[model samples]
Target: MNLCMIGTGYVGLVSGVCFSDLGNQVVCVDKDKDKINLLNKGRVPIYEPGLDEMLKRNFKFGRISFSTDINKAIESSDIIFICVGTPTSKKNNSADLTHVYRVANDIKKNIKKFKIIVTKSTVPVTTGDKIEKIIAKKVNKKKFEIVSNPEFLREGEAIRDFIYPDRIVIGTQNKKVNRVLKNLYEPLVNKGAKYLNTSRRAAELIKYASNAFLATKITYINEISNLCEKIGVNVEDISIGMGLDKRIGTRFLRAGPAYGGSCFPKDTKAIAIIADQYKSNLSIIKSTIKSNENRRNLFKKRTFQIMKNKIKNKTITFLGVTFKANTDDMRESMCLKMIPVFLKKGAKLRYYDPSGKKKEINKKVKFCKNIQEACLKTDLIIIHTEWNEFKSLDFKNLVKKNNFKIYDMRNIYSSAKMKQKKINYFSVGR
Candidate 1:
């Protein structure tokens, strides 16, 4: 199947590469000339695991290509997936669909053959209807359908998530659309990919509902983590006990800094804004946003509270910066929030992430070449992302360094182990 992925951001780049790896001739389109040039040179802009190798293999086989010429790519493609970003708008918490709308109009103006306009980007309900109306008005032919096929891939584990998803949710009951989609994804399904077929509107709603629910779960545990701190209860134990019931699984249960990244924060607010527009009161989601905001501030305060006096002239090391690790996306990471707070309190920041430093750090924050440089002679060490290297650090040697104090926001170290190592350790809840 011939496919064109508009917008070579994280989603576009990863999906296009994976689809190409699955034997589809995929072209990734981006208006950014430099980014497209970078991709053509076999360099991936995003920091997804195993993506670089996949891009190289696909390019060698002539399965995937990069282009800034949307006209040519769209004209030759059978399926055009709009994977552009719908970042939060400034005026309201609603998703800014300017890019999506622009892409729709562009496709309408260019396409002459019958094609499927698939929305691989996470958009609110009724967006497909709006796109359908816009395309129908501009185009003379009627051999087109709008399919809401939201992606559920996470950042660090995107490749595995795409190849082996929990379930593929394709929204469209139209027989022609379904047949085309089936053929397009037949390669993956043959390799054990399961899909949930439903209506277009329902599929859109499912994407929002799934993300909002997961955001709520993170907020729920974060709020409880605060209460656990006061009552001297271990939030981890509480979560494990609560999650033991098969109904409540143990994912997104880890307490840490506020939920950030490309999806949860933006999608939650956008979904809530849509719910408000329809006059449907989504109080739980509203509260979830409040909780998340409070969580970030509380983390800042917790750090200050732990070392209010001692932090005046200390070198503090942050272990990870990217939200949840694996990707260098610092869009809404807590590190952005906490870094300023600590820096304002006269703490020198030296942080190390296996992937994110080269992308996120600026002149204000000193980026270290290695974890040793980041941890060397630091008064306090804080683990932010729970990267595998941070989780497996030598605690004994770290304690021997100058002024050893470990604050594990990601819960990479156990309370008992820290105590045994004689390191002044702090963490969320227990």
Candidate 2:
């Protein structure tokens, strides 16, 4: 399969690399010449564990290439994947398809041969129809088949997810397209990945619905952690008890800060707006959004309580600042919202993430090169994200501060252990 991934963002880069690794020739096309150049120079722009090695291996083998020229990549490939961004619109909260449409228009211009145009990006329902219409204006329907194949790749675990997806969804009723896509994914299908073929709209909705439900699960657990905090219970035990059920598997059940990755917050809001557009009320999802928003403020209050309401001149350090561990993405991270508040209250702040310093953070705060630098002399240590580097730390020796407090928002540490160490430790639920 000769594949061209339009937009060499997280989705496109990972998918193109993996497809190339699977013996398919791939070209990752991005408008950003800098990112393309970085990839071509054997440097990855994004941080995903083991991605650089895989991309380099595929590139060295002459199986994969990165390009800024979309027209050349499109002309060279049989399958063109639109792996662009469809972020939530600030105006209506629906998915902003400006990038997707622009790519469609670009594809329309360079379809000299028959092509399989797959929407690998997360798009709203009927987006495939709009993309088809856009391309149809320039080329006949016979020249292209617009299929919706929304990516299920998580940011940190993209490589594993692509290779071992639970399901490969192809959204098209065209039997020829279906057979070709099935054959394209036959390697994974043989690896026990279920192949599901549905209508284009269903595939689009499936992506949003899956993200919304996962967001709800995270919100549900966080709310449970709040109740557990009031009643002296461990949210871990609650998570375990609920997860024992075969119906509700134990994923995204950990109590933590508000769900703030690239997908959850944005997709949940977009889907709620989508439901409203069809004259339907998604009360539960709406409540989840509201509750997640409140959770951030609650996290700030908890931090203040840990500091005994005296934040002035206090030195605080964040162990990790990204939304989750192993990814450099900081979009909608709780720390982004909390950092300014802490600075305004006269707290000197520093943060260290394994993925390195974040530009999203306020300039007033410091970026530590290492965990020890971030923790040294800090009055309070907040384990914001459960990065592996922060999991088993000698905080007593590291902080070197008497009576310093530790707030385990992700509950990465055992409260009993912290108690035995004679250190003041706070956790999500218990």
Q: Which of the numbered candidates is closest to the native, going by highest TM-score?
A: 2
Which portions of model 1 show Cα errors greater than 4 Å?
356-359, 396-402
- Candidate 2: Cα lDDT at 282: 91
lDDT of 2 by residue, 253-336 (tens): 999999898889889999999899899999999999999999999999989988999999999999999999989999889998
Model 2 CA RMSD to the hidden true structure, in angstroms: 0.8
Candidate 1 Cα deviation (angstroms), residue 239: 2.1
Q: Write the per-residue lDDT of candidate 1 for residues 1-430, one digit (tens) a residue.
A: 8999999998899999999998899999999999999999999988899999999999999999999999999999999999999999998899999999999988998878888999999999999999998898977646788999999999999999888887788999788789889887887787788877899999999999999999999899988998999999999998999888789989988788899998999999998999899999899999999989988888887787778666767888888888888888888998888887777878888888888555455567788878888887788888888788887788657545744788899887889987887778899987
Q: How many residue pairs clash in model 2?
A: 0
Model 1 Cα displacement at 271 (Å)? 0.9
For residue 393, what is the lDDT in candidate 2?
93
